[model samples]
Target: MEDRKVIIETGWNLDNSYANLPKLFFSKQVPTPVDSPKLIILNDHLAAYLGLNVQSLQKSDGVAVLAGNQIPKGALPIAQAYAGHQFGHFTMLGDGRALLLGEQITPRGDRVDIQLKGSGRTPYSRGGDGKAALGPMLREYIISEAMYALGIPTTRSLAVVTTGESVFREAELPGAVLTRVAASHLRVGTFQYAAEWGTVEELRALADYALKRHFLDGDGTENRYLFLLQEVIKRQAALIAKWQQVGFIHGVMNTDNVTISGETIDYGPCAFMDTYDPATVFSSIDMKGRYAYGNQPYIAGWNLVRFAETLLPLIDDNKEKAAQLAESAIGEFMQLYHSNWLSGMRTKLGIFNEEAEDKILIENLLSIMHKYGADYTNTFRALTFDDFTDMALFDTESFAEWHEKWQERLGRQEESKDSYHELMKSSNPEIIPRNHRVEEALEAAEKKGDYSVMEKLLDVLSNPYAHSNEQAGYVALPEKSTCPYRTFCGT
Candidate 1:
């Protein structure tokens, strides 16, 4: 294959840090050029945030770069090597259909990975064709942005590009690519791979790189590996707590999907909970409910334990001492997760001060929600807007009793009603990327080539913290369906 050399000029201030690491960490590769590359959507706001030239990115040459038809200047394209525990089964995995172009130095002096998903295959592709369907690419764009607006830590999608090709996935579907920006692509699985395969020096090099990139605030000079473990655990704990607060179901909590930076990645089969059921599972492959809504925290803790194992050799010279240190760190996860969840829940319930009964009050509301099959986001939004009187779940006797207790609890707060309302309004989002609605948008764009529906949905989701008249339609749950709603991976 020849380099197209399309000469894209999108103000790329690329710093290929990950590529500077040892060759054992990655395999260099070039993205396969497509026949007719086209830009479907370019996130102008994100482009500006990264100091990119939006006009250039919207041009044909830039489209070529985004669609993997061309590689930008100074871009060191590679498919990272790592291993992961998929459903508790260990296996080697990498960016099969993705390519890390390079890390862009943002205008704010922050470094972020600029990767292209669905960007053809490399050594890691295995037996699969490295192509992505249009619908799933758009699904990621919509949902990742929605999560960003809702204040969750997640990788942001910069743009979606059409390959002007077809991918045979269940059917012949239009092919596409997604530009994903993240703090960094280092994952817990990367550590696992280093520990299981690489030499000790290689493992330390990986840890040192991670510390420099993400955990520099900590005193990492003496026991940097342990510091890395503690920091990652803290971040994952807080991130999962935030997910639980908003009814987010990651669907697949694989170790590879757990970002070392603690940002949410891999939106495949992921969805927001429509009804407040702890047992809710939406991923088509999750037959056992392993990654159910309620199990996210536990899964996160479990994944961190795997990460801790990787660092055992680096944490201390004595294996027994390292095991004890790692155990203590992992043991503190649930407590950290509990505190983060409770703090967020308190803000949602408009509680400013701490109380011993706060956890009980929060759980009681969840229990009532579970009993009534109430919508998760709407229930919180109802409380935010003080419009719960007409909701079917609120009309129940259990809710009536709970409502009285909630009111009494609010009365006990030192904060004024206005302050409480403000907190609740900010904490509760009026919009989430609802599964059915996301399906609707994807279908419209994929089958009909009409992006108006998706554009409208994006507009409504952009300001999740504020109230708007246009939110009524999007805020509404889908009409009841007999079949269970399921989500599929982009692969």
Candidate 2:
């Protein structure tokens, strides 16, 4: 009550470009007002990037806006409509509990989506309550920020707040909202909506808008839709490769979660692997491991096929020719993914020059890690520090053999060992959001209302490449009690 006295800044330079789309693409909605909103955290750096004054946003009015209680001036909030294949099953889905609060135009003229996750109900809420528990919302805040700090393209968390109320899940839990920033909420599922629900005119408009918004450098070819599909395929391919390089398993690669902008979205049920197992699956719903660590690239390519299918009419007038073109475009995913993955592996291994056997060498090391159950992040990070203390964990004969071959390959590069090690160190992070550590942070926040653990964890993760005695604890793999950890969708 006392906090509400602070005047809210009404200087947001917001644009409603997305709301101008065909009415079928989205539904006009406002976030349900929360009771007694309170600030949890604010990202001053990200706030400045979006041209917001941090001092103004720190006031009570800012908390009100962030909590969806007050819409900023010039803001046009709406929930987008789309569909997705959930765990290999077709389903209609949309922004059930999220609202896009207009686009913010940064000083650089870049447009970013300002969205409120856990805002409230929408037309797509289905039969469920539209709310998010505090723990999972904070989990998304932590993990998404970590991913951005790792230099991977991803939607970012700008601020988080508590509704000062409870949301019902498995049990009663505190309610919170996460302010998510993204290139745009445009997903492969958006195109699917145009294809399956809207008219061809809508589909073409979406394609043209996406080209100008995301791929403006396009050569203006006769078949611009086809070019859009190829660009999405390439982006997804490269994005997945980066995920693999960093040991990230999205846990759910549904068509809706696949962004046309190629940044990682939907942090639900996501986890970074502790051990180097290719078959690792942490999402409780992924019983068959369809979105396992090793299967991400293939799953991305599969999603791309669905995206390409949506553009068939615009790709060509002849159905058969469109199918052929789609096939060729989808076929490029594997080679592109492999090239990106191998290139990243080469950098991780400190290989400055490409070699025919580089792929094999990298795979051999991974095989050894898999056989020995070596910790993925630690293993690569140890190499950067020239610390092989855990080398004994591997099969002595096998590791020595791989090391001999790898050394021979590295010797061929003109770069000095010091420079190569620096490159490797920068490429491979010394810290990841370890499952056990994340759980501990969440438990503290939910049970005791202590956020220091999560805050300290984020501080260390911010400098993932900087190794110090202080960060050694964050780098170690958790004990077996934390193994077989399962993440929830937190719906």
- In model 2, the Cα lDDT at residue 289 comes to 95
Candidate 1 ranges with C-alpha deviation above 4 Å:
1-9, 219-221
How far does residue 77 in candidate 2 sit from its true spot (Å)? 0.8
lDDT digits (tens) for residues 423-474 of candidate 2:
9988999889998899999999999999999999988988787876667888
Stretches of candidate 2 above 4 Å error?
1-11
Report the C-alpha lDDT of model 1 over 272-389, residue by residue, as the tens digit: 9998999999999999999999999999999999999999999999999999999999999999999999999999999999999999999999999898888999999998887976
RMSD of candidates 1 onward, in order: 3.4, 2.4
- What is the TM-score of each predicted model, taking all chains together? 0.97, 0.97
Question: What global local distance difference test value does model 2 have?
Answer: 0.89
Let me know the TM-score candidate 2 reaches against the reference structure.
Answer: 0.97
